[model samples]
Target: MTLHRFAFPTAIHFGAGARKGVADHLRQAGCRRPLIVTDRALAALPVLAEFRSHLDGLEVAVFDGVFGNPTASQVMAGAQAFKQHRADSLIGFGGGAALDVAKVVGVMAVHEGHVLEYVWDHPQVRPIVHPLPHFVALPTTAGTGSEVGRSSVVSEDDTHVKRIVFSPQLLARAVFADPELTLGLPPAVTAATGMDALTHNVESYLSPAYHPLCDGIALEGTRIAARSLRTAVAEPGDLAARGDMLMASMMGAIAFQKDLGAVHACAHALGAVCDLHHGLANALMIDTVLAWNFEAVPHKFDELAHVCGLAGGGQAFVPWLRQLKADIGISGGLAQRGVRREQLPRLVELALADICHQTNPRPCTAADFERFFEAAL
Candidate 1:
């Protein structure tokens, strides 16, 4: 095995009631005024009020206009809110969408251009502004691990393209993973996000990279998700299960720095065009993509099958996934989720452009993506 270096930049605090540490983290970071970016649903929750009360003397402004998949306009609105309040830091206090938008707000606020100007597709985009405002991410979901990641996903308004914003500076100054906050997440959200975590782990393990550490993390993360996600979803108040899922989620993000593959590529395209939930979309395509990529790395699946406690080798993994999805009430495929056959070609083109495509185990062409989409449908 080749030598590889793994870097984890963010300071993480994990457990029940970890949200209580947010104020102190802000104080330590020397932030007096911070912008709290979240969605309207979360903003209205009592947890948000409690968090605000804890902030007491610290000036905290709320921007709750973020939607399912954050848009460029939403980032602009968040940036405006940050600027208007003269926020010295950002508190991302919800799921992946909210955190992504908050990271974008931090990036665009200090930079001297429109959010679209820094989009990945823009050839002239400069490196993100350095030493951006202190970001403190508090994850209310048990997945997405946006709290620890250096990239943000923002959608383009005109073309509906979901663009990835990459910058090491976008990583949080600190992360608070409070399982108590995740207790109120709906069962569907819990199941979908958990599968998303599973996808991250699986893809990272399959990545043709030299990062043995990431491979180990990804394998163990998959085990945690397999053992705990169902229990977490079934018994929302189970602190142990929630904590394990939280760890698994963070591990999923960290490990995927090695790479993600075709499942994410396809899911990103679906999210761009159909407005489907990111995690659920990935869940729907997981089995199909796994089957497609099986030939490239069969033994990895065999190892995963053993780790997941399934019966056979590589083939056992797919059935295990199907059973898990069924138990979680995730029974539908892309067609059931409103993806039409006519959309395949366009989605394939978009999937091909996704950054995740670069790390796929087997080289995937437009035709390959179409076949995957059709098989998934």
Candidate 2:
């Protein structure tokens, strides 16, 4: 038997009003001053103001420099904001991009070098010797679940290649998963991010890594997303659907601690090369990659089909995913989404470089990646 370690350590406050407790939680932890790391767009919204109202008694500063995908420069700027305001804690207050930047702000603030040097692949990757600030997350969208994750995916400022900073210390001290915060998301964003949650569950379940705990979470997360995603997108005000999607998003994030597969590999490539939204990239590539991945893990596909309520079992799973994408407003292929044929070579190369596919049940080769991109296109 092989021995594998498992941990589920983030404290999550889930419900309609969970954001209301953030100030008290920080106070109890002796965090009087906190930096709210978020994007420029979210900063201009009323939601930010409303969330800030809950922290009325506490000293709060907002860092709204995060835009596009999280980047090295953004993390550096956020760290500067943290020092400038003398923040004792961090509140990640937007979508995945903002939350990813928030997770590493403290690393740059207290550590010795540029944020890229801490990436796991760096030749002299700096060790995370000191503790990060007291970080809490309040997600304004239901994707990536960066709030509960122990990793941050920040892109290089120049090349736009995504680099991951992984450490247990990056995990948020607590997560306020308030579905109300997601109720304002546009239909297109809801569709894309919901597909991202579904893809995480699907790909994690398909990964060959040995982690039954993650397998169980991934299946249930798949079920929840299958049932609730369309409703959430159609009726944005439906708190129940929004809440289920939120739970599914976090569950997918937790389950992926077992790691991911080719879908993520392709999606990360698209994010880096085409400047695509990570969630949308996942949405675009999931069915194509899963269709290619099916024969290698037929039993797993059958299990996924069962949970997703597809009567044709394994064979129906991919078709159902295709329909779901169309139903939720994510129609069309990669080409329709602005991916050019000339970019295919670079995408394949980047996909091959991404670490996510190492755990894929079907071992992916360069030729396989090229084929996957062509098929998706």
Candidate 3:
């Protein structure tokens, strides 16, 4: 075992009407002109208008270049927008992709080189010597919890390989998590994002890391998601259920500081090769990978089953996940969800290369990854 470090460092203004505080939060931080970094679809929605309505005393500009999976080019484009408007701060306003681009826009704006130079794996990665712009997040969805996350995941323009820009400084200065913002989500989006949250909790808890604090948070996060996801999807107007999902999403993001496991590795590979939505990718691969992983840590599965209120403990966990996915209209394997059988070699290679699987409770090999993809296919 190795020494571990634990830190939970985000100021959260949660619950209904939390979005109303963004203007004041910025003012207190001495920011006036702030760039609203968001996806084009979200930028056109009434949610963005309503959110903007609350910022009565500030000069606001919208940079709606973000779309699909976040990419290094999007970050550069957003940084250009930030400079053109001479924005003093940033407001990440949308789901994970938008928020991820927003998190790094300032990094690109102030840094000397290309955005890829900041990726953690870059051999000559530049240090974040200058202070990043004052940035805050307003999550409009109950997934990814990018609002409270400390890293920005941006994919390459050509290869589509996801590169992680990780640093404590990348964390949002504050997070405004208002469940009302998620009330407009369609049933499918709600289900996929909810599963993303659940996968974060489950995979983190299954990691072979030694963070008891994260383990406790992960279990409780799993419990919250288990009890609330169905309600959230079935009754989109149920604010309480929406709020529970939001809390669980943030808790999952926070808990994954302990690290994630093989599910994420598979999901990341799918995202790169198939361009699948990150949440949906996680949803598709979770059951298959976990079923295989069950043999490695049956006791952990027992703990998971107990938290989810399953009767058969470890024996019941994977089956419960499968049922849950079907209940929420996410019934499918990788093939059904658009992953081609021919992409197996690339997916397996990418999965094996992904850093997330290195911490899996069960050690995995190239053959295991090939088997995981084949089984799911």
TM-score computed on alpha carbons, candidate 1:
0.97
Q: Mind giving the per-residue lDDT tens digits that candidate 1 earns over 1-377?
A: 55566787778998877888888888987889999999989998898998888887798899999977889999999999999999999999999999999998998888888888887678898777566998899988877988889888888888889887887888898898888888888889999999999999999999897788889999999999999988988898888988888889999999998989999999999998888898999999999888889999999999899888888788889888999999988996788999998988889999999989789899999889988998888
- Return the TM-score for each candidate structure: 0.97, 0.99, 0.99
In model 1, the worst 10-residue window by lDDT is: 1-10
Model 2 lDDT tens row, 1-377: 77778899999999999999999999999999999999999999999999999997899999999999889999999999999999999999999999999999989878888999999999999999988899999998887988889999999999999999999999999999999999999999999999888888888898898999999999999999999999999999999999999999999999999999999999999999999998999998988888988999899999999999999889999999999999999988899988999999999999999999999889999999999999989
Deviation (Å) of 80 in candidate 3: 0.6
lDDT of 1 at 74: 96
Off by over 4 Å in 3: 1-3
Q: Rank the candidates by TM-score, best first.
A: 2, 3, 1
Weakest lDDT window of 10 consecutive positions for candidate 3 = 1-10
Q: What's the TM for model 3?
A: 0.99
* Residue 84 in model 2: lDDT: 99
lDDT for every model?
0.89, 0.94, 0.94
Tens-digit lDDT string for candidate 3 (1-377): 67766788899999999999999999999999999999999988899999999999999999999999999999999999999999999999999999999999989878888989999999999989889999999888887988889999999999999999988998999999999999999999999999999999999999988889999999999999999999999999999999999999999999998899999999999999999998999999899899999999999999999999999889899999999999999986888877889999999999999999999989999999999999888
